[model samples]
Target chain A: MSGSARVLGVLGGMGPLAGATFMQRLTLLTPAERDQDHIPSILWSDPRVPDRTAARLAGGEDPLPWLLRGIAGLEAAGCGAIAIPCNTAHGWFEAMQEATSLPILHIVEAAADELLRLGITNGTVGLMATSGTLAMKLYQGRLAARGYECLVPAEEEMARLVMPAIELVKANRVADSYAPLAEIARRLVERGARAVVLGCTEIPLGIAAGPALPFPVADTIDALARASIAWAKPAG
Target chain B: MSGSARVLGVLGGMGPLAGATFMQRLTLLTPAERDQDHIPSILWSDPRVPDRTAARLAGGEDPLPWLLRGIAGLEAAGCGAIAIPCNTAHGWFEAMQEATSLPILHIVEAAADELLRLGITNGTVGLMATSGTLAMKLYQGRLAARGYECLVPAEEEMARLVMPAIELVKANRVADSYAPLAEIARRLVERGARAVVLGCTEIPLGIAAGPALPFPVADTIDALARASIAWAKPAG
Candidate 1:
């Protein structure tokens, strides 16, 4: 399937609100003269699934079972492929694929490939992602092949710069809550970051590159959505 | 009840893709830290809902039933309120509230409140929504009361300037697709329209104001999201 008629299935609810946010991005990403031009999608929000970080830390509740169930539902509903928007849930990708017959798109891998194709290797990338995702070595491990060096916020930087700002949006605090992230970016720039990777989808919501940013911010969520648009369409 | 722990429900599926995109926005919008800071959300993507245009034309299947089902799910799940990202769905707001005891946030009205507060009334707003949303008078009707003159693209202009460019993103042809919308926007400025609204969420994904536009492109979405942030957590 090129683009016009492909169906997308979302295996989500690593946090329910985030799942909804991904759906919004699809609309923001698609070209529609009306709402109908948007491709149909199936989303299964299973927030009850084990917390992604907890699974990584304690091996408590695994997301693979719920992920498989959601994928099956989407496949039965006729989805062409599956996407999990949660930045952390991607850690279970191997297990998730083993559980489903349909093709599951890998967010980090997609991001790495796009970074490679964009020739973004060798720049100072100040990564902004969930603590779990950052700790998991997702970006570093993937980007290592491309020779791109990844830098994460210091522990104090995460507390002072990142988490509160992201929390503001989670708490529905939008524009005014940007100071913390902005301040963090400023420091990152002071520390010699050439570009900032909005690795967490939520970070891009209220914040974007300003004329005075430490550097340009690459919105990877937008990149993935744009990629999805390409993957779903007919060739020219 | 505030941002600290609010649950938001979404009545969605005007087209499954748009709903999915909106969900991505929610994730992007949040500023959560340890993951627990994220507000819970629920989504219902029912692609079976008749096209909004078709339903308006011949009184086809009313989407109210499905909309209500979604609202009910969120309320049942303990959502404090709801935000439906679909612009056209708001046309049925009356019927939607009839189905739920929970409060629903209206994007247009909420946006209007922000606009009025910004003192931009009587300002010329270049409308960039889908032909269907405009034809249905969803945004135009509400915007009229705010003393704003809404200018739609001329037929040839819309076809040559707007539609094809929008179709490019939907069809997933994004590279160089922006030239058309920017050109059309320049011509609209010559016609004396002051600022563009980026009315449709998807339009922002296509052509947005950087250093290129003739005037300000007020992204109403950016307004809504920013407003939600301040409203959620006012500075002391």
Candidate 2:
């Protein structure tokens, strides 16, 4: 069960697109020849969970029941490792990781490990994600341990900038959604971020590869993709 | 079953990385809430196919047997459409498409469709792919129908340039793979591509928004992703 073919499972649908992005990342990450070399992946992309921000701030319905159902299904199907593609879902992820026997891939741990390997120092990584991810401090908590800092849009910038773009995704207005991000990327450069992590998987959907503002952007989803590939690869 | 989930089943692993890139493109292209909201995808990434270029030149093993099995699996699983990520594999795709009852989303056709939408004409589309894709009429034949002029690397350029990078990928030597592609891209721009299609999905992995490249690059995988999303949306 822990070997090839039945390797990875995902608990997703925090926004469906992030999970979709992560799965796509999985496909690209595997090195294969015909069409069966990929590790078989079972994904539960359930978007019905109550908003994480709402649940944490004001007492709202918990997503635990739905998340556990997703876990049980994947476990029943014999998955070895688990991953949650949502950045905001990390609040529950700690609980989920502890509950599941499967080694869950935490994006925070994955990104931090990559930063360590890259020798990323006092350097600030510009984070672009949801209000929940920013406010909840999922990545911030783990990154603080590794001595790396996470920079985000200020209160005014986040409201006028990031949130609007996320709205465009929820609405499926993809092209229209990108303009605000392009503008915000300009401001983030002026603020001196060494690199930007498209922390939200949906953000990459909006970004076209270009040097609009400053510094290279490392997509956190792409980071997770690389991490997953590393995990899936046969150990030397 | 056809009411939703276009279900683009992929027969891949001329190289697994290529399959992964295609999945990412599919996810990127689909418009959805959680990953499940997009098309249901079943990927069979087989990495044991003979070197496509070598097989084309000499009488060697073919990928047809493997391709058929994967496509059959997709059909049995209720996939509505199928796509293979390898440019080289497209040589046999027409045969595979005919074998399956489901529609096969041709990546070349999809790219041309996007070009028409983008209003690209008169300029050349730089094609970065495996030698087999060029030798066979995989992209050229379909692109001709769509009124696109394809610009592929010269055979000498293919040997001196692109193959080295592909080998690096097989060896797991990433980061170094980008330099060869960068050099090749500059040459293609000088010869005449207005924009380059990282025709091979893996090339985009190499070409991800880096320091402004020598030319404008449109990842076919990106186009594939965007188009698949469009295909999944119920027409308004």
Q: What is the lDDT of candidate 2?
A: 0.67
CAPRI band for model 1: incorrect
- Candidate closest to the true structure, highest lDDT: 2
Question: How accurate locally, in lDDT, is each candidate?
Answer: 0.63, 0.67
TM-score, model 1, chain B versus true chain B: 0.76
lDDT of 1 by residue, B143-212 (tens): 8877777888877776676766755654445445578777766766777776766665546555642345
Error of 2 at B168 (Å): 3.8
- Residue-wise C-alpha lDDT for candidate 2, range B109-196, written one tens digit per residue: 7677666665675457778888877778677767766666788888888998797776665444556778888878888878877777
Instruction: Give a tens-digit lDDT track for model 1, residues A33-150.
Output: 4445665565665555656656776677776676676666556556687878777777778887887788787787667665655556666667777777887887887776666678
Q: How high is the lDDT of residue B101 in model 2?
A: 80
| lDDT at B208, model 1 | 40
Worst 10 residues of 2 chain A by lDDT: A1-10
